[model samples]
Target: MPKVRIVDIEDRRFRVFSSPTVPGGREFVLVHGIGISHRLFSRLHRVLSAKHTVHTLDLPGFGGMPRPDSDPDIADMARDLAEVLERLGIGPVVAVGDSMGTQWVVELGAQRPDLVTHVVAIGPVADARHRTLFAQAAALGLDSLREPPSANARVLVEYARCGPRWYGRQVRHMIDYPLEQRAAELVPPLLVMRGGRDPIAGPEWSRAVARCAPRSRFVEVPGQPHLVQHTAPRPVAEAIEWFLAEVPQ
Candidate 1:
């Protein structure tokens, strides 16, 4: 496992990632969800590292990366990610985002339509109203959503690195971000997939995202949870590989 590398892209500190992905392979950037860092996709990263140069980022305030106290919202994070990509000279690259990262995918694809060519989203929250759906998770008494494989141990540490106060603030921002209407506007060649047993995002939600974007396709994986990439990296990576290969030219 390669330790994450940090780079001062412009003024923001970015934890940049790059995998060999074969001698002469293409590159794709992986973006993680809230409270989770690049480590969320560790299993998938290792799997795909052989075929595609994989890149992940430790967005500000969420993975030991300095976050702006004032810009403590998804919009700000999106802008930061865009700058990170531009500064690193890594645009027009395939982007695979999960959950919160999916929100950034919408932001980046909409704002910088020319920058990101393809997007693969797993367990994505299509609309902000869906945020309320998470509260019900606690009600269901499901521990799976709270705990994942040890690979995500780093995510817990990264969230802790940001502290509870900041973490709560970010959650509040996400719950209040008014996402659905705007996300519907910027579809971009998207692949929205959900876990079959995912309490956070079920089939209806995935369908809504697919409907929101005519170009987007919705896939449902049976017997998986919120951590689709972690619980089943093979399927997630396979879906991503297929999407990348089938991307519209």
Candidate 2:
């Protein structure tokens, strides 16, 4: 089994997951959304790690990495992640992201084209119009974190990985960054997947993105929400596999 490697850049350190596969076949560097750790894809990682080298990193200000000193934008994070991929000798590898993470992958495609091969945006949040709605909805969902109809304490701990300050800065950055332009810069053959019930980046936004990236395709997983990767890992992985399978080696 390929274990996690901790990479230190200057004063910051990030976590990465490597696969058992030698030669790192079809590397997938997964950048998680705001305030989340690579563990979010624990199930998918365990499965994919068996084949391609699956590298998942903790963005600064989220997970085990130290909080970023400034209100960093997605581009900055993408560039930083690009360096990580380079150090791992992982590209032109496929880049997979969800929500905020997905947006970052778009930025990566725009700024560091050489690093990303196929792009997978799952439950992508391409703008503020959708984010404000989702944030409000997440706040409301937090209110019901009790039992039966509420989220558990453990998930709450996972949610806290973003930390109040980090999460706040992320929301601020998301508002300032112009994602529509970035979404349009995709290099083509982009795979966009959104959960049917994901309020943050619903079907409408997914379709919009598909239209924006003329070479893109969209898929909606039924009964899933913004965390489609978690709610339905198998299908998400399958979608990615299908997309990568078609990519010219």
Candidate 3:
């Protein structure tokens, strides 16, 4: 079982699930997408933890965690994530994020290069061509059709726990975030990945994101949907390993 803890950063609270560290293995931090929690990364965590230390976060206002009194934009959330990593004494890690979580990790890498060694974006969101709420929602709906029932069920349960009010508050930030711009500014190497069938993160956009980074690569998991990590953990893990090995550390 992973060690679970509640971490408070000023007014915001976060829930973290961490696995034991493997000797000689690098550390990894996983951040979930909007309206979801660390639970979505459970399968990926299990696979990655077999060789590396994995820490999954349930950001404030998601995963049944208490929300902050005021709304936090993308930058604020990134700063909070930095603080959490600092407090935990885990830094220079391979930070992985899904969907809107990719925005957060990009911002974190841009703002605090010392804390992140490499950044992995899985099914990154808010495509520049389709940044509107309607566009994103429509894309999400289409991706749902591609996802397995198990992936959809976990997303639905997490969304319920996140609640519409908080989700609505954060979606605005997500849509407004300049993920590609931030990724371009990152000092750490970047890996932009997407499910081959993901409607949200299209091939063109994923390639564009990879192009933004000075040091980056793009990988596509064949026939998977938006929540590919959940449905195809082994493939995702293998891609990550490949990226890390190929990229100059």
For every model shown, the clashing-pair count is 0, 0, 0
- Supply the global lDDT for candidate 2: 0.71
Compared with the true structure, what per-residue lDDT tens digits does model 1 show for residues 1-249? 554566664545778877754556666788888777877788888888878777877776677777655654667767777777787677676777887788777777777777777777787763433556367335223525444557446655776887777666666766665445545766468888887777666677677776776577777777777777887889887887777667672
Off by over 4 Å in 3: none
lDDT of 2 by residue, 158-191 (tens): 5686677778778666656666677787774588
Regions more than 4 Å wrong, model 2: 22-24, 126-128, 131-155, 246-249
In model 2, how many backbone clashes occur?
Answer: 0
Better of 2 and 3 by lDDT: 3
Deviation from native of the Cα of residue 3 in model 2, angstroms = 2.3
Candidate with top lDDT is 3
> What lDDT score is found at residue 242 in candidate 2?
78
TM-score of 2: 0.87
Candidate 2 minimal-lDDT segment of 10 residues: 143-152
In the range 107-127, model 3's lDDT, one tens digit per residue, is: 999999999999999988788
Model 1 segments more than 4 A misplaced: 1-5, 8-12, 21-24, 126-130, 133-155
Candidate 1: pairs in clash: none
